[model samples]
Target: MGDFVKEILVKPIQYADEVVKLADGAISFRQDCLEVKTKSEKLVSLLRQAARASGDLYERPTRRIIDDTEQVLDKALTLVLKCRANGIARIFTIIPAGAFRKITQQLENSIGDVSWLLRVSTPADDRDDEYLGLPPIAANEPILCLIWEQIAILCSGTIEDRTDAAASLVSLARDNDRYGKLIIEEGGVGPLLRLAKEGRMEGQESAARAIGLLGRDPDSVEQIVNAGVCQVFAKILKEGHMKVQVVVAWAVSELAAHHRKCQDHFAQSNVIQLLVSHLAFETIQEHSKYAIPTKHAMSIHSVVMANNQKNDMDVTDANYRNNEQDDECKSKIQRPRGCQRIVKCTIW
Candidate 1:
């Protein structure tokens, strides 16, 4: 834990402290900057607690959470510094209020992650209790607690429960880009991806769609892709319920269009080729009113493929029967089966 903490978490903690100082030091955008500062301060405290945790601190997922937290802090610092600039520097900075809001959302997610880690880590933070309660939510982002609740349901709930949770997640994510990124930062990708693979049809579709919407930034994209999104998508496209395939198809397209690098990922995953094979039999036309978008287009492709195979078999059987009939005709003629047969042929 000691070596891993120094290597993986120390730098991120430093970055968080830097964000705190920079946000506090910034003169302009004070209120917005302070929002970031307060969040960073909380993150630092949480991170320190996480560092002392006795569990497998070096695990890949743990490292990822800490690493991602570091990234948000770095972003916060960059934004705060830009806000700190004055005169010509300030002119070039062009800081926006929404930028701080987005960073804050990410930071709160980091705080939540560390808090969760503290609860699960061995010997627990409290030494007496095996589980620690979740940290309180920010007053400004009260919806965050609800978002976290749905994600929790997605993790361990039944099929119908996960499906409903997925729909709730999709709705919150669709409300704004910030909320989408927030879901990503809160470790929603793992369970969402799991549900996409194993849940009921309704759950799979919602889970797949939510994943696409979650790619609100490069960092989130990295998290989603690294969570095996491309592989999962490729598998589904090749052999999932046709309706689920359509949802995944739309998901892949949305992420690719949102990021050029994501397009490269699909090609690497061979999903692009899979999509082409699908398109050969399916039309591009789509309608939105169905339970799954593009349901009609894909349904036709399945029907067409089935019909084509049946037609080919039918033609082969017909040719075989015709050859048999010709053989019978020749045999009868050769055997001189009846004088009436010969007479009929001559008359014709």
Candidate 2:
């Protein structure tokens, strides 16, 4: 019985340690790549914490920690792949074709190795239905029905699953107004708003994109406003990753375009002020893509100012009308003759 328990528990702990070491090796291999290094370091930190926590005799590895570790590793792998692809793209433009091919092959092999390690480290029970809710629909099921299912996953899935589901929903909504509308109608806004506010980096990124895409639909704008999306977007614009900030700004622009209420909310939330501050920094202005969204935000600011001025004028006009009516009423009233006569005598 002791041997069986050791085999069941000790081996898996050893496997997890091996996985952590492999992740550390990958981190060292990509030390020069800051983005890759940052992500890998996070994975290492999470795995180490998990390992330490699991070592306690009275405790078992919690599902949340395991899920979080896997998610971090997944994000690290993605960053590694993206860094390699970017390197390849840059090298291909300057290097000989043979050299390019060799470099590409090396990158592919490296990515494959990391992918294999990730798979080996992942427990066999980590299926889509485990992290996500409910199994996928049968092949015979109608496509239209899948929308609700996807929304359900977005609402209830684990962090990583919710991120993917949000990305999938955005992809479906792109160029499809009907799908965007459906997402709003199906109660997707609340979950997305929460994700944008509290999710991990990837989750926030996907949620921002999804919200931005959905904001393009006129009907969805009010739903987004009621979800307090302006506050989330404002926070993202101020503190999110640069790529995500651009998307959030664009979404703000879209929401400002057709909805007066959204515009007011954004203005009141100080999103316009944040964008204006961004514009003052030379680094932000150097990125041309950033300018596009900043421009849109400034446009919203202009509209807000114009609206305020108009409101002020309207109030002034109303006050003037009231004053004029009061003067007319005073003119119609007869003054006492004795008072007038006393004034004439004093003057004489």
Candidate 3:
């Protein structure tokens, strides 16, 4: 193929990357932008795989697929621009919410076309899969193929792709302990840890949920913890939105359940303080005439472990019983065995 043709074929993939970047920057319809970003990423992956194989990318079938992909990406780019604009002043010119639905379906169709092209296009017998950056597995099990695909997407540069991959991993991990172990074995934790820090709030929440489910195997949960999941979770718990905070709390609880080693690791990360702030009592300034509530700060582990045991749990204290005490209140947190702390709580 001529240089011009190769450049023509490469433009769509480049455009897809651009779409992924701008989609993440969208200030409105962010979730829909994520959908656009994920689908565009799939197209990029599929198109690159097709190019890497020995198949003639400039041939009619591959050329047609690239052309269609570019058209879809053109629409996606337009949509992303509108989303970023927020359309507040667009009035009659505003893009409809359903526009995202149509664009996503078109992108999905393009992805399917590229996948089909990759499946049917014959490559040189000596082609090395390593050059393609895709698993060359020819397995009968669809689940195995699915797992590898998601793992590859997990390693993608965009948060939307990683978030989508993590959500899928959660589903796959839930199937059995074996798949969960396989995910960890395949080194999915590194990107996930990156996602926890770099992804948007929605993506971070999904990553945390997936990390918790992957902790089903205590053996591999330690791998995640050793990869600094505690530090990441602590950061999220400290700074992330409340929904994400709750998810990370659950993951922290899962990891901490495995060993005292993990708990100590979390303690060093100061996750204990972040977790406490969640269950912290209302401050005296928030409400003056409220009831004398009994609440205590607990580690993420203790908070989770104490949830079901809340009926049997109690706070032992010598602090002021007077609801109107102006002094700081100190209380003894009594929960499960091994989880006892003197935590200070406010009276509401």
Candidate 4:
């Protein structure tokens, strides 16, 4: 009994120590971007908090504490991976773009090593069992293989896995129009919509971006709408984290641009009002492009006008008048002055 108690008590402290080491290693990695460095620092702070919290446990840690610690570690690791990916992408896009090949190769190797370390370090009991004993599926098309792999990860992997997979899918869809169509045809939309509606912070952001990218294809617009993406986007826009809200805004805007039915879906979901409310926040005002809200307002306005034109009966006159008033309000609302840069960015 004594030995057992000591083992139980010592394990958490040991795990905490490992986490600190991992955090240190992550911070030591070259972070040329300010965003990457800030994220690494924030990750270290979270790890410290988690370590302190774990150290307070004299016995075996409670379920709640273990879960909480796992959540923090998952978030930290996801941020680190995301920062590295972003840095790699940025290097590829830099002007003159010298040494990008070597830089990306190094970054990719580092990311692989870190990801492997994180997977192994995670407690066995916490690991998802669905990946066990599954034979890998082979495909002729590399993109199809990637889409399938990400779908599998999203379906049954941990939060970190889902987040990483979603981000990869987003990048894949963004880089190729054909890939986006293939993703839609391969039943990627359902899983992506599921993640967007029910995933963690990073998962939600990636899923929204993937959906947005997929929405760029006009053929996928109705499919996305049918998957209840508009409702999910409206909810995310209203209450999600800042990064997610911005992505969701862009996504819904893309969907709205594709077809009139998508616009109708957004109007029915009250997405216009939700977006208008987002304008009240300074963070949203800064990060969000105005094209989304501007286009959304126009979509809603068109819907109301069409409704009024169809319903000319005396009994519905009052309803038409109400809609007209709403349209007036939407029309009179001016775009934010800071949106000039966003417009230019979108155009380019």
Predicted model with the maximum TM-score: 1
Instruction: Tell me, by lDDT, which candidate is best.
Output: 1
lDDT of 3 by residue, 1-348 (tens): 434445665878788988989998887789999989998888888767766753343244455557777888888898888877745444444778689999998898787767754543333232333233222221245565566556555553356666777888888887888888877876678777888788888788888888888887568878988888988888887787766776777777766665446777777888877666555532322332332333676556444444534432332132234554324333424222111121221101
Estimate the TM-score of every prediction.
Answer: 0.46, 0.42, 0.45, 0.44
Query: Once superposed on the true structure, which residue ranges of model 3 sit more than 4 Å away at CA?
Result: 1-138, 281-348
Q: Cα RMSD to native, each candidate? A: 19.4, 25.3, 21.6, 21.6
Residue 10's lDDT within candidate 3 is 81
Q: After superposition, how far is residue 39 of candidate 4 from its true place, in Å?
A: 52
lDDT of each: 0.71, 0.54, 0.66, 0.56
- TM-score, model 3 to reference: 0.45
True-structure RMSD for candidate 4:
21.6
Clashes of 3: 0
Runs with alpha carbons beyond 4 Å of true place in candidate 1: 1-140, 283-348
| Candidate 1 structure lDDT | 0.71
How displaced is residue 177 in candidate 4, in Å?
1.0
The TM-score, computed over Cα atoms with residue i paired to residue i, of candidate 2 is: 0.42
lDDT of 2 by residue, 1-348 (tens): 223323333333443344334433432234433433443444444444434433221111123223333443444444344334444464453323343233333333333323322332243335333332221121233333355555545654578867877888788778588878877776778878888888888888788878878877566788888889978878987887766665676667667665656666777888777765554442332342223233344666455545555655675677677876555444643222332222222222
Position 20, candidate 4: lDDT: 40
With a 3 Å backbone cut-off (N, CA, C), the pairs that clash in candidate 3 are none
Off by over 4 Å in 4: 1-139, 280-348
By lDDT, the candidates rank as 1, 3, 4, 2
* Candidate 1: residue 266 Cα off by (Å): 1.2
